[model samples]
Target: MLSFIVLCAALWVSFHLIAGYVAQRLPLDWLADLPIIGASYGWERGGRCYEWLGIRVWKDHLPEAGGLLRDGFSKRQLASAEPDYLDRFAHETSRAEFGHWLTWALALTFFLWTPWQMGVFMVVYGGLINVPFILIQRYNRARLRRFIARSARRSARAD
Candidate 1:
C-alpha cells in the first residue's frame, strides 16, 4: 500500500512535468480561462478568508517554492517593476495553474488501483495540498494581469 501511494505520487509528478513542459512550448493560455483554473467565480479575489488562512504568510515562508519551475524574477531584478517581468511572471502562473489541475487528475486516477479508503485519502490529501497552490496561482494571475494592463496603458500614453 505504501509503495502504491508512492507510485501514485510519482505518476502525478511525471504527468505534471510533461504537461508543464507542453504548456510552455505550446500556447495554452486559454486553458487558464476555464472556470476552475481561472477561478471565474471570484475565487481569485482577495478576502478575509485568504488572510485568515495566511496564504500570503505561508507563501512567504517558502518563497523558493514559487520560483521552482522558472525563476519568475531573477535576483537582481526581484524588486524591478518592469513590464516584461510582469508578463513573464503572469505566464508562469498561468502555466502553473494548468499543471496543478493536470496533477490533480492524475492523482485521482490512482483510485482505480487502490482500495476505496486509500483512494479517498489520496484524493482528499491531494486536494488539501494542491488547492491552496491553485488558489495562489489564480490570485497572483489576477494581480499580474491587472498590472500588465496598467503597464500597457502607460506605454500607450507614452507613445
Candidate 2:
C-alpha cells in the first residue's frame, strides 16, 4: 500500500543521508579501508567474542627500525613515480578494501539475527538496500577524486 511505499522511501532517504554524513566525517581513504580492517581485526581477535567492535588505539611506536633502514634505498625510486599513478593506485586499493569491509558489516548484521530471520533479512537488505548504497558511495568517491584532482591542477597552474 501507499503507507508501505512511504515507509520504504523514508528508510531509503534516511540511510543515504546517514551514510553520507558518516562517510564525510572520516578520511575517504580510511573510510574505505575501515570495514576490511574491522572485519579482519574482529576475526583475528577470536571472531567477535573478544570484542564486538574493532578498537583503534592511537599511538606511535618503533618496532621495525630495520625495515625503515631497508626502505631508504627505495626512497629515490618512489620519488621518481608519477603522482597520478599513486593516486589511481590508492583509489583502486581503497575501493577493494572498503568493499571487503561492507561485506563484513553485512555479515555481522546477519550473524546477530536469529537463524531463519537472518537469512530473510540478508536476502532483502543485502541485495536491495546495501548494494545500492554501496554503489552510491563508490560513485561519490569517484566524483570526490575527480574534484580533488581538478582542484590540484588548478592550484598548480595558478602557482
Candidate 3:
C-alpha cells in the first residue's frame, strides 16, 4: 500500500511535467477557442462555489511562475486589464485548464493498479484538490471574456 501510494505520487508528478511541457509547445489557439469548455456558463456570475474555496485569498500563494508542471502563464492581474491582454489571458487560461483536466484523467488511470477502495479514495482526493483549480480557471475565463465583450461594445459606441 505504501509503495502504491509512492508510485501514484510519482505518476502524478510525471504527468504534470509532461503535460505542461506539451501544452506549452503546442499551438494552442484552436484549443483555446474550444467553446464547450471555454464557456463558463454562468459559473462565475455570482455566489460561485469557488468563492467558498477561498481561491481569491489563496491563489496568489502559489508561485506566479507556477512550476515545472505548470508555467502559470495565464494568470490575470487587475493591473493588466487591457482588452487584448485579457482576451489572450483568457485563452491561455482555458488552455491551462485543459491541461489540468488531462492531468487528473491521466493520474486517475493509475488508480486502476490499486484496490477498488484505494482507487475510490484516490479519485476523491484528486477531485478535492483539482476541482477548485478547475473552478478558478472557469471563473477567470468567464470574467475575462465578459470584460472583453464590454470593451468591444464601448469602442463600437464611441466610433
Candidate 4:
C-alpha cells in the first residue's frame, strides 16, 4: 500500500509537471488552463456528467445559452444569471504550482524515510494541490466579469 501510494504520487506529480510544461509551450494560455479547469469542474460535478465515458459535463452543456454562460463567464455572472447556482470555478492555474511542488517534496521525503506517510500525504496533498486552482480560476473569472460589467455600465451611462 505504501509503495502504491508513493508510486501514485510520483505518477501524479510527473503528469502535472509534464502537463505544465506542455501547456506552457502551447500558443494558447487556455490550453494550459485546462487541467485546472477540468480538475475543478470535475470535482464540482462530482466526477459525474463528464466522467461517465471520459467526457466533460461542461462540454455537453456548451450548446445551451445557460451552459455557455456558466462556462464562459465568471462565478459572479453565473450566480447572477442563475441565482440558485453557486460559482466555484477557478480562473488561475499557476496558483496551484507551488502546491504541486510541495506534494512532490512530501512524496519524495516519505519515500526516502517513512513510506507509511504516503497515504496521508496523498489524501491531504491531493486536495490541497488541486482545490486552490479552482478557487483561483473562479476568482480571476469574477474579476474579469466585474471589470467588463463596470466598463459596460459606464459606457451605457455615458451614452
TM-score of each: 0.70, 0.35, 0.77, 0.36
Which scores higher on lDDT, 1 or 2? Answer: 1
In TM-score terms, candidate 2 sits at 0.35
Which regions of candidate 2 are displaced past 4 Å? 1-29, 35-121
Task: Look at candidate 4 and tell me the lDDT of residue 70.
Answer: 20
Give the least accurate 10-residue stretch of model 2, judged by summed lDDT: 58-67
Model 2, 19-109: lDDT tens digits are 3334334454564456543223322333222223222121112121111321211111123235564454435434433443344344334
> Over the stretch 1-159, how does candidate 1's per-residue lDDT look in tens digits?
799668777876786676566555645467555666654445545333365577666754433233445532321123557887676676667667676666666666766887788778877877876677776676666766777788899999999
What are the candidates' C-alpha RMSDs?
A: 4.0, 17.5, 3.1, 13.3
- Model 4 / residue 12 / CA error / Å: 6.9
Q: Distance from true position, residue 139, model 1, in Å?
A: 1.6
Give stretches of model 1 more than 4 Å off.
Answer: 39-43, 46-49, 63-80, 150-159
State the lDDT of candidate 3 residue by residue for 53-110, as single tens digits.
Answer: 7877976665432333444464746558687677778787777777677666665675
lDDT of each: 0.63, 0.40, 0.68, 0.43
lDDT of 2: 0.40
lDDT of each residue in 3-61, candidate 4, tens digit only: 97677767776756554444334433343355543333424343243245433323333
| TM-score, structure 3 vs. true | 0.77
Give the candidate number with the greatest TM-score.
3
